[model samples]
Target: MTDENTADSNTSTGTNTAEEENQSELTAVRYADGSLGYPAHTLGSDGNPPVDTIDLREYTAEIITWTKATATPPGVREPNTLAIVEFEIDDESVRAIGQVTTTEITIGDRVEPVYVSELRDPTAGIREPDSQAWDGYRFKPIE
Candidate 1:
């Protein structure tokens, strides 16, 4: 699975085959100390090494908060809905923030990560379209 948490080789360019195939995967870091963190870290928060890598997409999360951004950065959609959700994985809590699939959501709602080919229009940004990747996962509320 391609790690979608950080700017790795698979995500550095928009033309990468993995990205082109929409193979992005949301990953998290698991520390030896039993702590979990989003945006996978090279080292643990305690300064130790990571014990495992987990796919956040495999789990469901609870929306802790949400908001809509009317004034967004270039390439992002206007009135974009975003949320902070927490996942309970192996008795550990991992929180992540990302775009929401819809604005019709509330705190405490259950959500799952769904891969999207583009989070925003790469051509709309100041940078060259091929300079970076555009694919990522969005939070979708579960029924």
Candidate 2:
């Protein structure tokens, strides 16, 4: 007679496979240091991982949740309202900080990531600064 354990194992494996297939193919970028971000990547030779360019720029996401900041911390240039948001990018969750008016955000609103160019020091004249722009990302609602 066939082993009872073997029969149960086959059934469980079949159910797991079906559930996995129903899930989205997207996977989150959970780093070795325990930080999570989007456009999943693996470390490179230089020990820095680059996220996907196409995914960050072209994808539209729905806001899963967000909060408006109410306090100003020391050394902050301006005590502007900030929103800490969690949203999906290609089915993967990403948390990003953005400056937004307190009345602007809403749950389930569609948003997209944006990059802003870093400012240049006027004192460092046109000789071409030694470094490239360190632009950063933010999430904004799609118009």
Clashes of 1: 0
Tens-digit lDDT track of model 1 for 14-110: 3656444666768898998999988887888689988889988789999999998999988887778889999999889999999887778889999
Global CA lDDT computed for model 1: 0.80
Tens-digit lDDT track of model 2 for 26-109: 234544344556446676334667443333444556666665444544322133434555655444556655543224667777
Maximum-TM-score candidate: 1
Q: Per-candidate TM vs. native?
A: 0.81, 0.41
- Candidate 2: stretches off by over 4 Å: 1-54, 74-102, 118-135
Candidate lDDT scores, in order, read 0.80, 0.46
**Alpha-carbon RMSD of each model:** 7.8, 19.7
After TM-score superposition, the amount by which residue 108's alpha carbon in candidate 1 deviates from its true location, in angstroms, is 0.3
Tell me which residue pairs clash in candidate 2: none
